[model samples]
Target: MLSNTIFNTIQKISFIKRTKFYNFCKEIIFPFIVTNISKLFKDDIDEKLIVMGAFGGGAFVDNSKYLFEFLNERSDYKLVWIAKLNHVAEVIRKKGYKVVSTYSLKAIKLLRSAKFIFMTHGHMDLLPIRFSPKTTKILTFHGTPIKRVDFNIKEAFMYNGWGDYFRLKLKNNQYIDYVLTHSGNKIEHDVLSKQLLISSKKILPLGYPRNDILLCKEKEFTEELKKKYNISEGIERIILYAPTFRSNLIVKFEISKQELNRLNKLLNELNSLFLIKGHMVSEKIDFNDQKSIKLLDKSADIQELLIISDLLITDYSSVQLDFLLTLKPVILFPYDYDEYYRTKGLNYDLEEIAGGPIVYTTEDLIDTIRNIDNIDYKFKEKRIMLRERFNKYVDDKSTERVLDFFNIKYRA
Candidate 1:
């Protein structure tokens, strides 16, 4: 695997350049087109709900796809999705929805005229999009309890580079409205915004419609996943090792050539196979020839993986919060806990928020695994507790709650 520091540096350069280029187009071409679209599409503004899945990857993919399925038969909202990615746009188009390629000044105008807009989620990149303050925006917050970055008097005085991002982008909570809840964490509703300095009345504790797939344990789906990996019918357990990206990037991930060697050896010895999955930003790992330990190459479908997965070992990927509905065992591997807490920050401390086991070292991880050797006994109680707490309703009809929140009546 390539070093994360080098990868992140390259990505940051590419990100900055991309942001500048897009913002320039937004400022120049978008206004002219949006103005015209408003006149041309005045007749259609109330006919369709234009949703910008501008985040344009797995996160938005999960939300948009599920919403599309729910609104498939409804004629109230035409339900147009704007996509920037070719592959994902193709996926959405395949589902019979018209996709505006993305960022055409004309398209922005059309989006502005829509009756409502779903801001897929929190994205700082949107700081540039020109739309009227009157546009109805729904910010679906996947994680609402995100810990705020508190600047110290001393740190602010130093004028550090690390403080600059928080200084400019965050400093306030007035950017978004209407917190769409996935886990239904009521604690977020009571907490007041620091920047807004007033209570937000738009926090809706509705369940995410996308995660409905996780609740389904169909024999056909489970069998297909096992067959895909050539895992025999029921020989061993399926453990998912999904880790989020480390903001610090370097210290959070200490790749010991020795540890990789040890992990390869341990995989050969272990009974339950571990599928190593990197976060969206994490550098991909390539294993020479290992069956028990494998790395995900380019499979976009995570819902299927979640279905076959029996025990999940994740680190703050929000998938931990997503998978909480199933009551699966999640193990947090915060090797860079101090660095992450100091820098990236968490909405809630893992000790309080994470409803599962946490391991800080290799030996401790192994010991935790042994202690929970019996799959049925290990997570039975915790899973049930998580299920009732996180999920208000775990059924095919979670779309109902989402529609109730949006006031979009479900037709089918």
Candidate 2:
């Protein structure tokens, strides 16, 4: 109880002030804990079971979604998920599965016992599972790279900040067994290898399992989602606007009333429904009063929404890569391009690879949407080239390839 209170108080202190304290913990406290962990807990590790954690259990819609479903169907293995919030655990429980709290003793035992541990993100919540000595760690990686990642910059990662104490010194990813990747793009694969500090041999070029759903023609699912979202009878098409999560920039771009009015008018003229999905970390803007636009929260399934969207609008987001699998039109809205480039450092040129018109403002966005039919055809070849370069195995057999690596026979 006292330790928790002290840690909470320390967290409230500014990051700069708390650096020395975390460094002390890393140098002195960590070794003592690691050496004595066996004395604190007594349980034989279970090799058959696989344990997984992601985004602190806010949503189960990433790589874990497919892996969980796969493991759940196989009665031979036990799958345990660790969530920070009880409500998040409850949602998983209702899915006919088991979930343990991040701070629970059960989670500790599972972490110590599990043979395989998979994490989608490398945040602090995953520390316990990630550091487990016996487990074979695999990261499905949350998204395709757009901005320069932590591991890519050695000075920023290892020397410049206190973040290195947590990300590198304590949870050293050197022990990672494998990291997933998509094939055909040598540049992307090389960048991922360098970013992870893992050998290229350990990086599997298996296509992302999450993208497999986009390749299917789920007419019934699409109809059901439309009904669930309350789309009007006359809506001809749906345009999905999903932006990538930015660490430094939290506030999303807001539209003025005039711009909103114009957007609504254009949607009416195009006979389209505009669905806006903000980054998971973003606060929802009040668009409830707007009749033509539907605001989707973090809980919404982005893949399902992408399936129904006729066009996609984004800025520096990897969702553009995922949407390309559908051979649909996309518009790049880099309103803060200079600011973003300075801070996050994009790997590729936005205009060069956008596969459609790269708009700098909301006015350009509206204009592009108004003339999308011609724009789609104009960028058709570019989109195909980008798709071939990034996605080598478009046949949707990525999940099977991953399972095959572990010698797990997939019956399907």
Candidate 3:
């Protein structure tokens, strides 16, 4: 705990990242150590072996999780999940899946010998490791980009200086062999290629594995979710409010008890349950004993929640694009639009991409929810158009397509 506190304190010092000593350690010393350590292992790539991880192996969620599930069901391939946290490993173990600790000797051996290593965030998902040149590293990015990412964002380049940026770029190019996207559109391809520092050819528009569940109607999963959340059968609707992470770590919402009570009353009157799922990095909003309002687990698989939701309320999140596939009602609540735009930046203006009502205040948000039926009807065409622009594939066969692309045969 003391060591962790010290590390956290050092990380909070902004100038440390810009120091010459830090750059030497991060860009030079770290890679050198990883490379030398990796050399100790043989480059024996197992064609049937695939290792996967996400969110630095702290949680099992995202495109990698779905892909892991698909492969786990098959008999031909040897699948393993690399978990950095013991609890995460235990959870995967409870599901009767093979999971190894990221720092374990078994994990290092698996990573070095695996033919394919799949990740959602980055290579760090299986941190402090290096892969064989014969191994293929595939990045199934967490979401469709609505905000700037990686080196594409100005802050990333300016924060660490050009030398550090180039070093990071070189590392990314060396590590990631391929990246997956939801669509084949030129703009999408270009954005990913630029942000990820990889060639356009390496960006495969094979669709996202997580979106597969969203396209298909999973009644069993819905029932499972209902039981897990203890949601009653009498509930008419489930409205999910998921907001993207803010750089400042502030939640720009009315979280006062009075306001929460009012929102809860509105949800109760509509026979609906309002759920708030904040981004992993975002500040948590206190629901404050409101019976109709619930705060979802931060590490929950949101794709499953999206499956059971009647409506989605979000602000500047790529989740809006995923929810559009459901052809359901969405309410955009960008209360801090100007401030967010200035600090974090967005790829496209909200008005240009929003397929539903855009409300700015708590009162407006409540009013919009009250009249959601009409709003849903009004945005039908717009939603379809936006969905097509964002997601090219609308079927539940993305996992199959991914397997086919990789030529991984599964028994029927």
Candidate 4:
């Protein structure tokens, strides 16, 4: 098995630059060996067994986390979480949930025998091996699409030539049995199907399980976060600054130390706590010793953060769409719009979908934060409009819908 560092380094190399032998081993040789070996096991899939993981098994978060929580409370199925890291496994085990190491023999057996396998990203959620054909593979993708994804992106590393593209399409279509989407709109469903290289019938517009918590436990989570973070007394608001990951560029604070200090002072005056939650793949920013600013743990669930936040600040992230559910003000900070657009193309025009003020400068961001109340009032209708376009169901029954769609029985 390749270490993550070497694997990531190899992935960063342009596909065309990689040797033919490397590409053959990766795209063809590997899958053939895994598939034939998996067939030899002949493990009968257990009808009630369900296995799930997210963020390459390094985090217990995203659609998988919420759905796992829902199923964990019931006594209908055998639930297992695949954890790549020992600490992650320990954390979930401490909570009395079943967790298996990604490389464990037990985990391999589970993957071979699970009736249903749920993942947020791809094979990385569990072991990157071909599973039994009887296993139902479901991808509860982490976010709604705003940026181009999978085959839709022209510069994606998976495609070196037409042959690589066709092979990937075949592999994806074979592995992914179903994909969950938030909106019921056919346009969105079709777009997702094409991007994922799967049949349109495979797309399930059953809403996102992650959004269920946003609707069901807003107050509970808000209070929990305030206490957990030791929020200062008299703090009136919580502002979440969540930026999307960039493939070709780093996400930086951009503002100088003096400007950041000034922004911190302004936040203090507003009695607000500003939380910075960068994407998992993004560069980390330090906010230690800043009274008003806090850099959230990278592993912290963004949905939980969204529920606790009074307002959101972001740039081209699907998080802004999720924040629309809160009906709170959102401020877009597209500081590198041109560069980002050039590298990672957007699926939609940023201006068309922006539900709030779009600020390109630190000064503008600060100004917008200072006048957030006015921004909130002015953007309420826009947020509602965008929400309708994106989310089909606003209720806390998405998890229920998913189970019903799959005909999985559970306790009421």
Candidate 5:
């Protein structure tokens, strides 16, 4: 237990001193307790399963979405989903799935008892519980990472996570057994291993289960979405511009109001609806007056949007890789490319491997969108090569592959 004297001393000290004291407690004292407690209750634990996402706050999106759909119906193992918010728990409960708050007594018992724990993000709340030797941990990464991530820091001021660059080196590798990888290449694997300090052998090349929905021919789902969005037949082309968040960004977009108007006009002329899907960190954007341009709600299913979209416009987002499965056209809008590269380093040169025209200016973006019909055909061969390099399986069997590898059978 932390002493009151430590708190008093922390209060008396400078900000730098306080930070050091907190780190000492967190990195040293806290882990020691968790490690012992985990071992003490190891024998009492059950052979159950637990799945979480985005620190147990959000819905079962990303890889967990596919896994949940498959596992929810099965009667194999004792399953429990840890959601941080009551609303999220309610959503899961409405579907007849067992759910609990992350801090609930049930969750605490389940965390200790679950033989296998699958998560999109690290379970920071449950600390020092080592993987492999105790519980089998599987990390179904939320998205394909195109940016410098994990403990890989390029700039000092840009990073806002725990510990200094040096201290965070191997910190992320703690209590994790298997890491799901998207790229099938050896070089990319090596890069990822170095970045995350994970072993190459532990990296599973099971293509993202999330992408399975992309391959599914959900005509009904598409039609329903079309009706909801007022997208009629013969003019059903949808252009989705989903951009990545720049941390602590002062300026959002490089385009002017007039440029957006021009973009909207072009979309209207082409019988397309331009949708803007902002990042979670992005501030509230309103294009209500612009009829052709619409900002998707925060909770909108991106997969559904992707399915209906004829073209995608993005800058340094791994969503581009998922879009590759559709073999659709992507327009690169790297307006702040240099600033982004300097602040947060990219894993790949977006301009080089983009497989489509890279537009820097707003005028260029309008031009690219105007000729999207021809542009889609231009990058077919390049997209094919990119897919082969990144995706191990282009088929919809990725979810099945993951299940089979873990010996998790589907519901009869």
Candidate 6:
């Protein structure tokens, strides 16, 4: 099996090397042909509207939509449009904003005219995307950056999909105009502003602005989503298993199967709703569901679900920490934990970080749930220690605070 696995690895690299290298180079070379060196910051910071040269998948897409709308209503510095995918770009376009694709010729042209370039916890690394300092790049790091993301460089450089498309395995030393982060918690060890090292002017904390909606009750939205997906009623409890992908050592885009009978069997036994929101780069799993257990490809409204979910099952996912802010239960299912930790890595120990149960097998996870009521004393202790540090706001002004820091001046 080991020999066959080695041969398969070689075969996969050989196949990707055959055609994708040239295509990948095309994407890298696109920067030169994009907007000229001087054009990135040319339009005098068009306050009438801001232009974000965006990337990444859903998190970025979702947050940008809200930001775009907020900016349009209150200030002249709206993110007028984005060079992004349809889900977010389309909605903003519908709001009378332009939504263009990023990296392609069309994207490049959009950036040429763009006065402000921004990325929000998205996948599009600004290293290759950086054309000029005048462009004014704003990076709103979605989650706290984990300590170890790259597992094997040699193995990664040899592949296509697993490397650059997901993690920014490359190093970027460029200084951003502003880094709008979920502050209140120290990004570095500084925890607060005065002891900072990086440009103190740019390290503005805005609480987690996007989680505003997540903190609310979107029952209608949930019902609509459930109805649209034809999800059956009688779901007593909803649990989201969001696992963060480790780098090359952790195969993010792995092939998975629909455990139809297994899933149903478990659902019948446990009587709960389970959602497998695979990491952004993770491969798809299609298990057409009847009533019991349903595996989703991905859902755009994850924050909404996060609000409704009773418990969260995760593995090295920052979402677990995010969910903790809601004062809920979280469980771990680190199936490839050792391999993931050795290869890619974590900021801190998972056991140390989580305030909840660390369970692996399905039975173990179910058992944790069964005994969830009694676990609050331990979780609350961690929450009390970490809450003030991580969350600055006990209310709904995170987005407003962020926009204010950007000097965008949008209304609440």
Question: What is the clash count for each candidate, in the order shown?
Answer: 5, 0, 0, 0, 0, 4
The TM-score values for the models, in the order shown, are 0.74, 0.86, 0.88, 0.88, 0.83, 0.75
- Candidate 3 local lDDT, residue 191: 76
What RMSD does each model have against the real structure?
6.8, 3.9, 3.6, 3.6, 5.7, 7.8
Tens digit of per-residue lDDT, candidate 6, span 1-412: 3432443364346446446664454334333333244244344434344665334422234445556656667766545454334454455566686555443444544444555666664224322443444555666555554444333323324443543454322222233566655545555334222221236566666766667776665678767766765556777777776777544322232322433455555566667777766655445444465365455545345675677677787777667656766777777777777766776666677776776778756556655666776875678778655656556665667777766665665555
Task: Indicate the residue-level lDDT of 163 in model 3.
Answer: 35
Question: What's the CA error at residue 106 for candidate 5, in Å?
Answer: 2.3
| lDDT tens digits, residue span 3-120, model 4 | 4445446546766435776855655555455445555565798999999999877788889988888899975799999987666777899889999876556777888899999999
Residue 164 displacement (Å), model 2: 9.1
User: Candidate 1 lDDT, tens digit per residue, 1-412?
Assistant: 1322332354457556345455444333433344344444443445356554535333335555567656766655667666544555567777777666454544555565666666554422132243444555666544433444333212222433333433322222344555565545455455424322324566666766677777776789778777886666644677777776443342123446566566556655665676766555545555665556666644345666777777777666667767777766777777767866776666666766565778888666655655655533655576677666666666756667777766777665
Query: What TM-score does structure 2 among the candidates reach?
Result: 0.86
TM-score of 3: 0.88
Can you write out model 2's per-residue Cα lDDT over 172-240, one digit (the tens) per residue?
A: 355577788766577888877766666777777887777777887878877887787777657898999
Q: What is the lDDT of candidate 6?
A: 0.55
Off by over 4 Å in 1: 1-44, 54-60, 73-76, 123-135, 144-177, 183-185, 191-199, 225-235, 248-258, 268-271, 374-383, 394-396
